[model samples]
Target: MKRSSPANLGAEKGQKQPTMEEDKVRSLFNSKIWDPEFQDTLKNEIAMSKPYNWGTIRDLIDDDLLRKVRKEIETEIHFTNKETDIYKVNQSGDLANLSGLDWNDLSRLPSLCRLREILYSEVYRDVISHVSGAGTLSGSKMDMSINTYTKGCHLLTHDDVIGSRRVSFILYLPEPGKRWKDHYGGGLRLFPSIVANVPHSDHSAKLVPQFNQIAFFKVQPGFSFHDVEEVHVNKHRLSIQGWYHIPQEGEKGYIPGEEAEWVKTNTSTLAQLESNVLQDYEFPKNERNILPYHQIRHFDELLAAQTSEHEATESSVDLSLLSEGELKYLAEFISPHHLTSAGIHKLQSQFVTKSQLQIDDFLNDTKSEVLKKLIKTDELQKECPYESVNVEAPWKTALPPHKWRYLYIDGKSHENFQTEQDILNSLNNEEMPNYNLLSKTLDPVKNNTETELISVATFLESTAFKKFLALVTLLSPLSEQVLIRRFRPGKDFTLATQINKNDLLERVKGFVEAVLEGTLCLTPTDGWESGEVGGYELYMDNQDDDDEANTDIKDAAVYRSDDTGDSVLINKPPSWNSFNLVLRDESVLQFVKYVSWAAKSSRWDITAQWDVKTVDDDSENDAE
Candidate 1:
């Protein structure tokens, strides 16, 4: 064989030399990115950051290459809108896994592949490792997804603590030259931690994104709570979301139990107080603890005074056309239809048949208009202080925000418990704050002009209203609780679940819950159709496997999706002058979906509950 030159020998083995163009493409990242001084500065910034260790880099990549990459993504990728409990956004189903794609696939998206290669190159990986102090991230285990948040899209709070993730990042690619305004609202909001696993209610820091900028942080489990604020207006916030994982077996920093330890420390679970203080905080506490005999007798005497015993025993109680005095009190808030005989008959018949009633225009037009205007003004003009420490008297933030968050007039006492220990102590002391006092206190503060919310609550708690409820449900109310609530836009919600039942309260037939809601939808933008932006109240039949065996099964609040044939009774949105009444037997699950920041206004309502007595069907049949 002829003696071959070195180049000829390499060609014989099918090896190709790197071209000048390939070398230039590989160096698409900023040269200064690899400088030691730059890396140290980034590291220091992350170390000193508040809420958690995080940092941002502007113009992280070569300007021309990033622009080309953005063009490729916009033209070549298909995106689909995804919605779940955790987030809502448009996402590209095509994952950025370069190693898995064949040459044929790579050829179709050359710029994207090049961008991915440069981002995961060893030099960049080392830079990220040094800055995050995450130690030897796995370059081979690339994880990234492209997402677009248009108007109304949001990602709820969550800590990126799952699996072997060491760092998380997002690279923004909005319109190339236009600046994204703060009012547009798609900011990365970081939350402070209250304890090991609990995050504070409000976000402490927000980073408004820009084209060619990247925000990143060490994924510190519970300490890294963050969320994407809803995009407030019509615009697209495109980004590439990715994570750097801990080193694999052959890579550096592959500690065997590090991931497991992180999971153990950051796993989602109820706080100690949530499990132990149910009776003290939740409604219908000790449901079996019937109203005292004297109290029931007192209500009975009131009913007897209104109607003769013979008239009360008739199939229908004459609740229509209340005395002029009672009607006048009710007319202040109640709709004329509800005060009429025909309306009461219609509602009573419906409640008897379905155990639920929804009354539209529940409040008179005049009252509804005034309340709506007042609520709209307050929601628009008043700043809602979310944390309990910031809330003023007459308006208190609901406690243990892990369960719910809102401002409410509980009408009893004001007890602001700042710590979990304080809550536990109060529970142990059996302290029950009376919301009635809160209502009274609010009256004087509003200059004796009781807020429309207070007026509604007052009417609901009045003995006449209770009698009206009794007539509709054919039950005798023994005791009741009323709450005037303001579910702040973007900050309040109650998760899907059931009422808490007391074994002692099981002796009574059931309880009644009524919500008179007026939505002050002030969302400057539309698209809150169906339940997309949430804020809807939902009710479902409780699916308890051992319901029959359990004495208080009807009062049990537990719910499961897998239970066969469970069904929903109602799903209604917040409306002006609407009233919903549900007769719960301990087996109904209900919840208010989290109101989105996109909502125009707060969800204002009067909520009330009554423990009532029901005649046993068997005893009634025997007497008949």
Candidate 2:
């Protein structure tokens, strides 16, 4: 490999020519790194590694020089905390194109400029190529950034399969000589792919990084799944992340169309994973497969009994004031205000116009106080038992931490999987865990419910409460699932997206298909001011060009920082005794943002969903 001149050093009009001192400063890498024997050993190790081909080298740079570089970076560089759907970390602006910096810029941080050159030098590139067998790397086409993951910062699962990328590497610069402990988290965890694009739920390997160590891997599209574990303590995990690109034109090993070919193959693998065969693994898992005939009949009977008793009224019905039995059942948890005639009228009118409603002080004062106290006690007193195998019953952690990670009552007894293969096999067999059985077993009213979680689930699932949902939405409930969720600080989130619709399911007469969702929030602390520290439920209008009618629906967002046209229909933050109800069509996107580590307590909520039937327009009119 031939070394290219630094991008910023070449002479411009009235600028001084490159000097010998600059060249000497750039050659700061450890010379022993270029030895043939070392390179060969690294190559063999990478080829033999499990999950993926990756290797790490210790003391790859001159220690004194690296220390100097780290000091310069600490004193001179300004970092901005950046957050997005994929990552949350403090980072400096791009350091890759440092050659474009003027002399005045370079003069202030000479060590950083030299460090960039040393990492991208021909000698270092050759060694990297020999070890990883990633072909020729570009010297001129540089790409690198400095990032610091302090407490609670994390990067979720992703393959560094972006444009023109060939290899990826991270050089750690944690406090020198003081070993970065495993319990402090911030390890680079690697996931094994089930197939090309499908990654398993958990990471199989992890590298606990230290100062002066560089971890590099060939950038395998779809297969290179990795994430930075959330830093557990108030410590900084600083590193330089960069990529070696396929050689550009005029560079050795440059092949026309090579980059394009890699991109095409990567995109095809992603498309493959999105096919119907893999829908079972997707989050929200296949649109609540229809209930069995016996189960449906049971729910139908509940509705039928209610229908026989309440005669059709000429004016709008008050869902708040239900029959004596129903109101009594609901009063155990539901707020009196929400059940009032005026409150019911307000909620019904909002839902009629907007398809969603948010209710605060959702639970009656006495029940709300008990539930909140129980939840707060659980959060403060109970230690979360998260294990790779043999996890405790009633609560199971949601998997594929790339998507979401929270303790949820799957409504079933917890089953443990010892390995990625065990999980993959379970998924392949289509073994849907019986969350309903778990719910039934834990229902406080029905069984030995030892906790508020069980009591909440039981209340949400009561026939009377389901009837209340029907009255408010004017949609008859058929099948339902209720989950008591605990989103621990620094541990959980769900990304925004619409549910997949099953077009094949037949629509029942006098009914349109919809999912009725209700969430009763029990977050016990403040500081969830807006969307910051997350744990906010957001609803956005689905962008679907196929629906011509929806084209006129302005693009919007709930928690938008700026007024761009994306429509955000609703945004609700975590609050005590708050409840949100949304009647969703297939065209609405919903998600709860990740809770930050700074939260004083976990976000507690009882989530319920019902597959419902909409009444015919004439019948609705008659009921009104």
Candidate 3:
């Protein structure tokens, strides 16, 4: 049924009222959008929208019809749990397949079917295209799916630049009578770009949707970056997400080769990002700065001499070989129990078998008490910085945010990356690690949490720590990165990512390549042990699959809806004082889950990584 145009609805005052066809058109969508003045306002709003060209309208769908549609969705749809490195949500199979539904589904979803038709109708498409200035849209190729964001569901930042999609939209359908508030979470957040393809660390604006509201934007590649904030409460957030495709053949305004040109111009950013070809644009670049030449040579010489002397043989490694002075330096940070010969033997044996270990009470009593006390007090007394602008001296936010977002102290003279120029300057003037400056600046006597953490990061970089590491893992360190990271409640995380195989292989010359990873968890909270409230360290076999249940993901890891089973080899929740060590190859993917807003405090930890090599004669296979 064709709806009358706005010109037909524009009858002069006291002349004739809207025609019957016009009334039908006005009744489906909110009547206000048919007004010339309102359309003009919407056009201007889209033109001036920040981060990208976008606009939203409240009460877009007729309330009664939408409520019926929501009920049909609730009753008829089978929502599958969809998860990935960047998002987690319950998703329905494509609504475009509504006609192909089985008898029960088809009979139960009449209102949903109507809603879809009205949405893709020529009348509605015209309003969207004209307002957003997207030239044309196809009615034939309807691409849409339903998503429900329950508690813990989230969608990370991405510019919706897929093939032929000219405009993107989401029509919200929360509980009909309830108001979705700002504090409810699940807000649609827009991020301003630091440069093309580089979104800032934090969102610039957010929209808390109400029932029958619709938010949309022109698909502007490299500029339209947005995310759905994780829903924190137990409320169902239902939405219809769809893209208006560029006109297809025989459609009005169709242009040959337009889509192909657009596709070539806007290649998937994920492919380029995974390869790290755009490293310069990435903040806190994943590049691991090598230790000084003398230090590298020292480890090389130590490994060669140890091999020649038949020390730390294939059977076991002896930590007791450490000089008294070496033991004393480590005693300040690591528990003496972990330094004993028995401790080293047990740990080595376990690592030799499993290639991994998680040790509790990893720190000495003095250091543990000091750090725990300081962290707890700081949480109670000090406010955590929620904004990059509020992030004080010494710490920097990990960015462009598609990859990760957390606060870290890299033991460098920190500068805020406020603009494209700031980041460019950093790339132009890169420097190597300097623990000397870190020691001179952050005083251990300050009794401050930040300073204490920085001190720990520096200590972890020391030769003494590496000696103990070499003893247990039986791999000689070639290069390393030690970072003191704070995964703030509600705001920090690392998306799942594999170690760059090419980079690690290049660093480790010929014999087997591996990276030794260690996590020292110092979180002072309590309710995170179950990994239910987030803040967990997870490692998975990247080569595995989620099975045929999810065929869309080609290179998937086997996963249960709750993230259990053999795929997840290790899952450690936020803890008081513990250390986890693992030697992993490029096939392993690792990430710290995003901490929930309900958590008591930030998930504080010191993360350490080292590129290493196997001894020439040993033939033990990888234990992963």
Error of 2 at 471 (Å): 3.0
Listed in order, each prediction's TM-score against the native is 0.73, 0.77, 0.87
**Residues 468-511 of candidate 3: C-alpha lDDT, one tens digit per residue:** 77777667676788888888877888877777643534644433
Flag regions of model 3 displaced more than 4 Å: 1-27, 80-84, 93-99, 102-105, 292-316, 443-447, 501-511, 544-566, 617-624
> Residue 267: error of model 1 in Å?
1.0
Among these predicted structures, which one has the highest lDDT?
3
- Candidates 1 and 3: which is better by TM-score? 3
lDDT (Cα) of model 2? 0.66
Write model 2 residue lDDT over 1-624, tens digit each, in one string: 001111112122233323335346345666666678877887999999868999998887788878887887788777766554445677664343354576456666777766776776676788898889889998767667777889867776767665567898999999897999998889999988766555665788999999999999998876888878888788989898887878777778889988777665655332333344445444334345454545344444444443433346423454433568878778878788777656665676677677778888888888777777766666677775544343466666665444556667645555454455655665666545454455555656422323555766767766677666765665666566777777877667765555544454445554455677889888888889756577888777755444332111111111112124355677788988888889887677677777777777888888877776654434433222
CA lDDT for candidate 3: 0.74
Quick one: best TM-score, which candidate? 3
What's the CA error at residue 65 for candidate 3, in Å?
Answer: 1.0
Q: Arrange candidates by TM-score, descending.
A: 3, 2, 1
